[model samples]
Target: MIKFDGIAAFVATAEAGSISAASRRLGLAKSVVSERLAELERILGTKLIQRTTRKLSLTENGQTFLPRAQRILREADEAAAELAARSGKLAGPLRLSAPVSFGILHLAPALTKFIQEHPQIEVSVELDDRFVDAAAGGFDAVLRHGAIGDSRLIARRLATSRRLLVASPAYLEREGHPASIDELQHHCGILYSMREGDWRFSTEHGWQVVRPKAALRANNGLVMREAAMAGLGITLLPTFFIHEAVKSGVLVPIDVGARAEGAELFITYPRDHGASAKIRALADSLQRSFGNPPYWDRLAS
Candidate 1:
């Protein structure tokens, strides 16, 4: 009979290239990982890894077996999760990756609430704003806003994030408030993820585009928000990111005769996984938590 723990240890050691590294990655002691590897080799009557003074390398058998071992582990995990879900008590691990700002501001709370509801669920999260390969990262799903550009992943719309033009009261007091879109264009703007252009809004007439002077630019929405709060310049950002500041009167909304284009928040998973039971449970939790129009939108109103 093949044991999963041994296979897992072998796979980790093979991929990590050293027992010590695998131990840290798997949260197991080096001796334990070594013992598991030896036991698996004993069962198969083959030496899997070559250990030397300087380095470790996989034998041909180990190289051939690595992919199959990984597949088995994945299947075993999926089976356990599916059984738990069918019984109406989801369990096991659910790993995800998300944008740093959304992960900190919104996703973290929702995850906490769900975990509290299901104590047996073990979750691992990676919060980053960069585009990452979900499969390569080994995340069960990803939380994202904007286009899912990867055809390899399936996405579920969680909510619509509406962007609004905003500035600190101090910024408005310093720079003078812009009463219309035309006037708003005259003010230098804090931009997110773009170097040359600034604002894009939807108005009663049509889509309106403006290229304001770039007061500051960054890849992160939080950076732009912080810049706006520091009275650097007016910024158009999502309500979720700025709602609390706006509600606290630290930032004020500007009616610039158009609505800044926002994005649809999505919870996506690799298409190969086919929306596993555990992933569905997490998605449902997020959808319920966000709600229609989202809580942030209501608060901003």
Candidate 2:
């Protein structure tokens, strides 16, 4: 007889693309996940995944069995939900994902409050800036910033963050500030490697784009903030990350009245499960916590 636990572990490994990722999502130890996968493969007498240093990829047998496993699990979940609904109770582990910097600066604090309010719910949060596949990752919710892609995921707008140009006062003193938008061409920029060269802005002449030479470039927002604070160069960053710094005079807005392409913060989750109470509760919490027009939007340019 095949063990359902082993089979479910295999399915999670296949979907997550790595044993470590599956372990984190499932709240299992790395050794346990490995043991489960090995047991499942032994029972089936076939390899389920091609484990590589870079990532785990599903084998032919694994791919063929994935949808079947997912369907079985979904049915089980539906059955449990139906039974639980009769008692009118919400109980289940809720998995969530969010950008690393945003999670550190915003979601992490909110989660502390959420956990206090809902003691019955168990929560797991994954912090990464890379685009996440919620269903594949087995996440119940994802907090993302930017234009929400037109997908099956249900995205609830949490707040809007304005894009602002900022630099440390020291940098301005040393490098000389740009007097106008046109003069920005002569100034150095702290480039965000993730967005790289596709900067859009709103100015007196309306929308404008600039490709400035970067004195430094980094992939993470916190790193960019550090660089800017150290008087590196002017950077176009979301006000959410720099508002406090600017308010404290650690950083100053460069083009005071200019606007830029802003991104909407969203709480996105898989639509396949419809809206579960877990999803709704977390979404509502986020809406209440940051939805009242985030302080970033009110930052003085």
Candidate 3:
């Protein structure tokens, strides 16, 4: 009979490239890891790894067996998770990645409720604006806006993020609102540096693209929003960020007789291993919390 511990140790050691590294990863002593690897090699009657004082390398057999070992470990984990889920006792660490603006303004509150409901599940969230490789980053899931670029990932649409062209009431009153897309070129713009300098709007003829001269260009949405609020210039922003300002009459939406397309917010995970119960539960919680129109949009309306 094959010992699962031996298999696990072998896989960890092969992946980590050294027994010392694998021990740290698996929370096992180096001697225990070496014993497990030795036992595994004895069972198979083959030396899987070439160990040297300077380095570790996999044998041809080890290279061939690595994928199978990984798959077995994955299957075993899934099976355990399935049983725990069936018993309604989901417990595990769920690591997630999300955008900075949305994480701070929206996801933070949702996570508070999620933790309250599922006390056994431990969650670690990384808030970043840059694109993250969820699989490589070892994240259980990632919340992202716009289209999913990686086809290897499974994506679930969480909500639609509507954007609007907005300016502070004082700014509009002083500078006067542009009546058409062409006239927007004459106005000062507060641009998000991450996006294209040219703004696109749906028109009766077709899509109209206008590049406005930027008075201020910023990477952070909050910074751009604050500049716009200070009567700097007209800016394009998602409703999630600007909704409160709009509702409070600090910012006024510009009626250019055109609408910008809404970006889709998706929760994406790797397709290799299906989502675990804790991940599924977190997704469910976010979906329910966001709702159809989303709580933020509804509140603003």
* Residue 241, candidate 3: alpha-carbon lDDT: 88
lDDT, residue 71, model 2:
57
lDDT of 3 by residue, 133-159 (tens): 865455668999888989779998888
Model 2 over residues 94-180: C-alpha lDDT tens digits?
778899998999888888887776676778788998988765566767888777774768888888888778899999999898866
- Residue 76, model 3: lDDT of 77
Off by over 4 Å in 2: 1-4, 16-57, 74-89, 203-206, 299-301
Candidate numbers sorted by TM-score from highest down: 1, 2, 3
Each model's lDDT comes to 0.84, 0.78, 0.84
Segments in model 3 whose C-alpha atoms lie over 4 Å from true places: 1-76
Alpha-carbon RMSD to native, per candidate: 3.5, 3.6, 4.4
- Which structure is stronger by TM-score: 2 or 3? 2
lDDT of 1: 0.84
Query: For residues 18-79, could you state the per-residue lDDT of candidate 1 as single tens digits?
Result: 89988987899999999999999999989889999999998999888886886676677789
